[model samples]
Structures are given as structure tokens and as C-alpha cells.
Target: MRFFLSVSCFILTFAAAAAAPVIEPPLPMEKAFRMEARRDGPDIALRWQLEDGYYLYREYLSATGDDGKPVEMSTPPGVIKDDPGFGSTEVYYGTATATLVAPTAGMLKVTYQGCQDGGLCYPPTTVDIDPATLAQAMDPAADGPVSPARPQSQAAFPLVSKAAAEPVDGPGIRISDQSANGVVGSLLDRGGVLFLIAGFLGLGVLLAFTPCVFPMYPILAATLSREGESLSAGRGFALSLTYVLSLAAAFSLFGVVAAWWGQSFQVALQSTTATLVVAAIFMALALSSFGLFELQLPSFLRNRVAPARGSGGSLASSAALGFSSALVIGPCVTAPLAGALLYIAQTGDVVLGATALFALGVGKGIPLILMGTFGSGPLPRAGQWMERVRQVFGFLFLATAVWLADGLLPAGTGLLLWSVLAITFAVFIGAFDQMRPEAGGAARLAKSAGLLAGLYGVLLAIGAFSGATDPLKPLAPIAAARSDTTTAKKIIKDSFQSAASAAELSSLLKADANGAPSLVYFTADWCVTCRVIERSVLSDATVANALEGVRLISVDLSKITEANRSLMKELQVIGPPTMLFLDAGNNEVQASRLVGDITTQAVAASAASLKESL
Candidate 1:
């Protein structure tokens, strides 16, 4: 009876679990949405309203007229696509505005969907507006003036007669199009340029605790507390702040240069150089933490420290020192910093870039400043224990460096280099620690010298290897290039392939004469989330079966090639596992585009939506 009861309870629990509703976070609502077209200006501004936990994918817009065909909208001459601000919330949300050159006043249609926290999905909605109506609405003295005191139906969503203008071949604007003009859009409209400014600041604050900046906290705190006088706290605080500001300034400058360089370079940086650089920086930091070498001044350079000796080490001096320290420390947090930089670079807006950098620095600097002001009571005391702490940090840095270097190296070479470095670091640090005396100044100095030698040896080896003929070099380029080519070929072939091949495999579905509504998912093996979707949803029997009616194509972007790279550019695909849907005519359908995480439901819905469009 007891066993029977146990089995019954298990069954009940399973049933309850299956029956439980899936609670998801609220979909980001448009905070603000507005359309601005000045008679004097050459372009129309379609601004968005992005709310927390929601974002609009910028690439797949309604490029066609209501006939469901892709059409090019006039954008301001010389205007570049702006990087949509992916804000800093756990689920970031923000507004984006695009300036399009329009030949005549017509309804601009925007469509979007919302995902609720409870796993409930909102179908795509469109917001449509005639430019003429917007122009009239903007003017208080227009022929048909509506009072602000009137109801929203009268003030905001006014009725318009279709007979006033002949239907043109231009894009059909729908009232339901909410691409940019949603609740969040309104906020952005009200905030104007200031919203972007605030966003940068917010991003900066969040960057402080990232792996890049976190390690510096203890070091900065230790440096500040080393000043043997209580009066030095203010100086230390000032210096820390200054140092942070300098880093911000430097990053801002970088942002300007990067932005000018454009997105292609940014992609290259993210994919290749940036990853390697960040990994190297982390490895170096880890080694330093392990007491591999002390970054200190030489006797000649010691003269510079003399200024820091007396009360002359005022707040200004401290700030200068802090700024100097930042130059070295900034690279450590390059990953997150690079993200912000990339955003700024993509946006090509210097003010916005500067603001973002400033915000990041401020966030990173806060803890250091507070630690300096409050003293090192928050940190572990400087003692034998501190040595252990430093060693741990060194290992961390070493690991980070190895991780980064792996990106630049071929698979075998990267693995070899990482292994060698890891082992070398471990042996050197262990030997030095064993040789050191328990509590003597001379012993400490000797240990420091050993660390220097070890660091020098490691760097020398790296330099030699970097310059020497690498067996991996030839293979690396070929492998990378081949990868790109493979991806491109797959994309092009799958896009143009005979749907008859797919139809031959199944009888329930027929490829329309034009083609069936299909979704092409560009993915990669290296992408973490791509594997997840493939395993969880793409491989599911139900999903696979559902895909029968609609066509599905998967392109592997794991390999690199010029063609693949070009396709990526053409599609404006930023990251892996991007979904693009097309109609039977092989024309693009602006329904739902998802990047990163893929779910069975999303695929199903996308298929359903495309089917309806057909």
C-alpha cells in the first residue's frame, strides 16, 4: 500500500508539473513612438519606443509595400544605419530612430510582436500612418485642428478618409504597425536626445562588476590604503576617480575611431582580434596576480614616485596616478568594454560613445573610490594571506590570456599554447612560493625578482613563437577561409534550391509555384545557443513534423569565406542563429525574426504566420 501510494504521488506530481503555466517576463512595450518630418528637412524620422525587456530587430523591416513585396525606402543621403541601443537591464530595452528619405507623403507601416513572461505570445501588430496626417498633426494651425483636451481617438488615432488620396504603389501603412511607435516610443520622444545619454551612463555603471574590472578592486584598495596617513584618503579617492575618467575618455576616443571604421571592422574585431586581445590581457592579469612579476617603477622611474611621497600627493596627484593606472587596467576589462565600444563605433555618434564610456568608468570606479575613502577594511589584510590571494588572481589572469590567445591560434596550436602556458605558470608560481621565506623584506624582494624573471621568460617565449614559422599558420587561414566559403555556399544554395527535393520527400506539402513560405536559420557550431536549439527544438519530432508544411533551411556559418562573409553583410546578420523568412515568390517576409535563443513555439509561430501571409 505504501509503494502504491508513492507511485500515485509521483504521477500526481508529474501531472501538476505538466499542467503548470509557463510564466515569462513581460514583453517590452514601446515606451515612446513618434514620426517627425520637417518641411525643411530632407528625411522623415521614424522613432521607436522600446521598453524594458523588449527590443526590435533592426534588419528585417517591412521593406515592401502592402502588396507584400520588398521595396526600398528613401533614407537620408549619406546616412548610415545606427546601432540599436541594446540597453543594460537584465532584459534591456530602448528606442531607435531611423531617418528615411521619402519622395511623397504616404503611410509608413511598422510591424512587431511581443512575448509575454507567461509564455504567451502576441501576434505581430502593425502601426500605420500617412506622412501627410503626421505633418498636419504636428502643426497647431492646420486646417483640421484637434484639441489636446479631446479624447485620444480624436487627438491621437484620428479617422481618415481613404478617398482623399489615390492608393499608390508605395508602402501601405497600417494603423497596427508599432515598430517604433509604442508606449516606450513615447518616452523616447519626450526624453529626446537625453534618453541616449542616460542609457550610456546606465551601461557604464553595469560594467563595473564584469570580470574585467572586478579584479582591480582589491589592487586599487590596497594601493589607496598603503598611504600611511588618514588624510590621504581624500587624495586616493580623487586619484581613483580621475583614473576612471581618463579610462572613459580613452575609450570614448576609441569609440569615435571604431565607429568611423564601420561595422565590418567591428565584426572582425569581435570575431578575431578583440577576442584574442581580451584573452591575452586576462592571462597577463592572472599571471601578475600569481606574483609572476610586480609592475613597479625602476630607480630612474622611481623619481616619478617622489612626487607621490609627500603631501604633494594631493587629490590631483592621486587622480593622475589613478589615470595612469587605468591605462594598464582598462585592457583587462576589454570584453565588456569592447561591447560598448562596438556599439558606439556602429552608431558613429561621438557624444553617445563618450557618454557610454563615461558611464562605464563611473560604474567601475565607484567601488574603488568607496574602498579608498573607507580604507582597506573591506579587503583582506596585507599579510602572508595576501600573497595567496595574489597568486589566485595570477592564475585567473593566465587563464584569461590563454582563452584569448586560443581565438587567434589554430585549434591544435591554441590548445597546445594554452596547455604549455598553464603548466608553465603553475610550475613557476609554485617554485617561487616554495622558495620564499616566511617574513622578511629581503625574502619578499627575492620573490619579486623571481616573479619578474618568470614573467620575462613567458613573454620572451611568446614573442619568439609569434615571430617564428608556425605550422598552424597555413592551416589556420585555409580553415578560416574555407569555413566562410562553406557558410556562403550553404546560404545561397539553400535559398535558391529546388523545393521539389523537399516536396519529393513528403506528400502532405506542395511547394507553391512561387515557393512555400520558408525560414532560413543561419547557425554555427561554435555558437553556444545554436547547439541548444538544435538539440531541444530543431530535433524535436513535433517541430520537425510541423516544418513539413513550411520549408526550413539551415546554413552553417561555422566556416569562414569571402562569399559567406558577403552574405552575412547582405543580410546584416550580427550574430549566429539568425532566422529569415521568405514567401513562396522568394521575396522576404517581415514577420518574426529571432536571434540567439530559438524555441519550438517561435518556429511554429513563424511558420504559421508565413503560411497566413501566403
Candidate 2:
């Protein structure tokens, strides 16, 4: 009876098991995550589709070419998550694509890893693609990196960056198309060899006309004119060549060092003491040109020092002057120069960057070379005309000295010096003296110029007495307003608070909670461009109105102390004239950052944009 019960029970259990449903196994890893690759012109495009309950690790996804060299790639931002296996990491769900610069001509290889939700992690998988296959699969629609979906909050997505490399921290806010430096940098990275050469050289030619380069001309002219009748066209060409080469060398060496080391070496040379030293050099040169003294070695050491005057003193002096001028005098950072510096800083490519800078110097020197060669040809060879020419260059040297020292001098001293110079020039040209009836056309022209100089000098003197600072706008302070209460515009005082360090700046930024935007201006007393922007853009009526509700902060790098250096490094400030726009949350509105030159319209527009974003 018991045996019969057992058999019946076993049969019943078997029948119950046969009736139960079954569970299916998970799908293969390949089926869970699918990848596609294609050629997008000179670049490679990659796309991955993740099935539901599946995600790919961003750090695990990488690509390389047949040459076994890793291809440079840029991907969209991914979702941040804390994983049990990997701690905090970035991962992608749904679908996404990555863009890579095409590597050496060969097969493309891609590798990635994925994991199932609440389940096992898959091992890394590699996919090899033939170059021919990729070429045949070229997509006409995909020209660049596809824009990924981003958060709607302005504070979350400050700006979309199109840089080749992904931003490691925040959005990679850089000088863009609106900046000439950015354009040049872009060309350096993507343009053809011939195109880059022509473009940078042309840019150098254009920069030659700027105010920064004006002082160099007078220095070179004085050197050649001092050589007088003995200078041959070839000799003049040789001296000019030496000067230009030295200048180019200085720029290249200093620029590369600055970019590599992340410090403004040229800017450091603009300190008050340094400027005074350079001014003293110019003054000595001017006195020599004025026939006040000679620039010769002492008699005791002359024979031992140099054998030939032309080969030793002239060429040596030219070289020394060129190098010094490049360092201290022409410290302006134009677009092309900034571009080359940017490239060097980004790539750490001293060789190519130095070469480009050298080419730029050569382009700027073309006019100087021509002038040096032909300047002596027009001279009268040791006569009153030659003496007059020498005297003119002496005045120019004196003017250059004054300009250099202006920034370091007391307020209004520059205007006084200029007034004295103009008056002296008028006297030298016989402005008030009686002229003979037989005087020629040239004499009348000189008298006319002298009269104008005398009149301008008188104006400058009056303005100086009235405590004016700007030589260009001498009488601005003294000029009566149309109506003080009715027509006078509101004066905007310096509203910027100083930030001594990065920590202090951060605290200040966070302390304000009112939702008003903030403007952080990076400026330096030694920076000429900074002064101009402060005078023109920041002080504009429209800009001031736009920034009415904004908190203003200034960080002065003029002294370059350790604290300032740390602040600049943390802020990623390459040089002055850099403005940072911040929203109420203290997050940088990356798109609104300004580098190099700025205009009133741009400043106002940036402020408005920051406010709107907030």
C-alpha cells in the first residue's frame, strides 16, 4: 500500500513540474549593445545603440587605427552615476555618437564595454574596420560631431563647446570666431600647410601697422642715419637683416617659453623699473642723435673691444636694440601672435609654434628692411639737410622715450612733457622768427607746421594745468558741460572690488545670491590693451547701463605676486583683456567670456546674455 502511495505522489509532482512556466536567458552582449562606424570626410564617426536595461561605460569606449595608434576622439557628455563596481563614473544609455580625427591611412579599430542592469558586466570587445570599407560607408549627412541632448537649465549647460577635445571640468570656454586669435588658432590646427603660411604671414603684415610697432621704425631709422654716407645699400640691408633676425629670435624664444610655462614673460618685462631702464636706453640714443654725445667705446678699450666699427658696433647695436625692443616696447598681443601662443600652449609644440612666430617677425620686418635699404639714398651726404634729418630722428627718439615712461610717470606729466617737446620743436623750426621774402616753399611749409605745433603745445599746456591725463583728449576735463543737471551724463565710478586670490574670488562670487549677473575683469597696469578697453568699452554708457545690476570684480596682475599667479592659473587667464561673465549661481557663462580686444556693443551684449540666461 505504501509503495503504491509513493508512486502516485511522484507522478503528481512530475505532472506539476511539467505544467510550470520557464524563464528565458539574457540576450548576448552584442545584441544588447550594437555599434556602427562610418567616415565623415577627413574624420571618423561612431554610433552605439544600447538596448533597454543596458549601458556602456564612457571610460571603456576607445578607438584606434590599424597602425595601433589611438585616434583622437571627442564624445558628448554622459550621465554621471555611482556604480557598485566602479564607484563614480560616466555612462551612456539609449544612443550616442563620437567623433574622431582620422588617423594614419589604415584600418579603424573600435573597442567598448557594456553592462546589463542589475546583472553582470560584459568584458571589453574590439571591432576592426577596414579603411576601404569605411571609405565606401562614408556618410554625406554627417559633416561634424552631432550635438547631443543637454539639460535645459542655463546653469547646467553654460555653453556648447565645439572643441576637438572634450572639456575635462567645465565647458571649454575659448576665444571663438569673434576673436581673430581663435580664427588663427583654428587655422593652425585644420588649415593646409600653404594656407597656414600665407595666412599667418599676411596677419603679421597687417599687425605691422599697429601702434606697438611704431617705435621700432624710429629706432632703425636712427641707426642707419647715424651711419651717414658710409652705409651702402648692401650694408644697410645686412644691418636691417641682423636686427630683424634678432627680433624674430627674441619673440620666438620668449613666446614659446611663455606658452610652455604658462606665464607671461614679455609682460613681466613691462614693470616700472624695466620700463625706466628701456627709457634710459632710448634717451641715450636720442642724445647721441642730437649730437650731444657719441656712442663709442672708451679709447682705452676701443681697439680691444672691436676691430671694425661697421662690423662690430653697428651690427651689434642693431641686434641688441631689436631684441630689447621686441621684449619691452612692442608687448601688445595681437590676434596672430596670440593664436600662435595658444597653439603652443595647447599642443606643447615648441618647434612649429616657434617657426610660425619667426615667420611673423619676418613679415613685419619687410617694410623696415626696404626703408633701411633706401633711406640713405635720399640723403644729401653730410650737409645741413643731413643734420636736419638726424635732428628729426632725435626728436622721434625723445618722443618714444616719453611714451614708454608715460605709464610709470605721475598723472599729467606725459602731457607736460609732450607740450614742452612740441614747443621746442616749433622753436627749432623757427615758428615765431621772421623769415626772408626769398624763403622757398619748404621754408613756408616748415613755418606752417611749426605754427600748428606751437598752437597744439599751448593747448596741451593749458590742459595739463587743468589736471588732464589723456594727451589725445587733453581738454576733455576742462570743457564745460552743456548743462550739469539737464544734459550731463551720469559718471560711472570704478565699481570693481579687488580679489586677491582664487579662494577669495570664489567666496565673493558665492556670497551674492540676488540673481544679478557678475563680471570678473582680468586687468594689468602694464597692459596697454587693458587701459584702452577700460577707457573705451568698460566705461561706455551703454555697457555701464547693461551692468547696472551686476556685481563687478577686478583682479589686477600688474605686480604678478604668487597670489595673483595662483589666481590666474586657477582662472585659466593667459593674459590681460580677458573678461569672465558669471550667472547668479557663480557658474561661468562660457559663451560670454571675452579675450583680447573688446567693443562696447560686445560688452553690453554679453552682459545682457548673462542676465537673460540667469
- Candidate 1, residues 1-614: lDDT per residue as tens digits? 44336537744753554355423223323222222222213434454445444444444334333455444543212212233342222221344434444446455565544333223233344655455544423334443433333311223222332213433321121212222122223323455334533554565566666554655565454445434343455555554555555555555554445444543223433455556555655555455555566444454544555455542233333444455434333433232344344344332334434554555566667676677666644444457665665665565556545544543554356445644554465455453666534567766665665565465445444533444222223234344545845322111223323212222212212335544666657665444346456646775655665556556665555554554554443344444566666666544555455554567898777666667778
lDDT of 2 by residue, 1-614 (tens): 44336537744753453343321222345567766665555666667778788888888878887767888888878999787778888999987567778765776767888776654466577877654555323223444332333211222211221211232433222322333234335554455334455677677787776677787887787677666677778768767877877887787787887777767644656768778888898888778878898776555565644455532346656777788778653467665676677656644446556767766876787778887787657644567876787777878888888888887778888899999989988998889999999999999999999999998998999989888877777787777433365432322326788787766676676675665567888888767777778766766678878888888988887777777676665555667767888777666774677766677888888898888887
- Angstrom error of the Cα, residue 61, model 1: value is 32
User: In model 2, where is the ten-residue run with the lowest total lDDT?
Assistant: 151-160
Candidate 2 residue pairs in backbone clash: none
Name the TM-score of candidate 2: 0.64
Cα-lDDT of candidate 2: 0.69
Q: Could you tell me every candidate's TM-score relative to the true structure?
A: 0.43, 0.64
Q: How many residue-pair clashes does candidate 1 contain?
A: 58
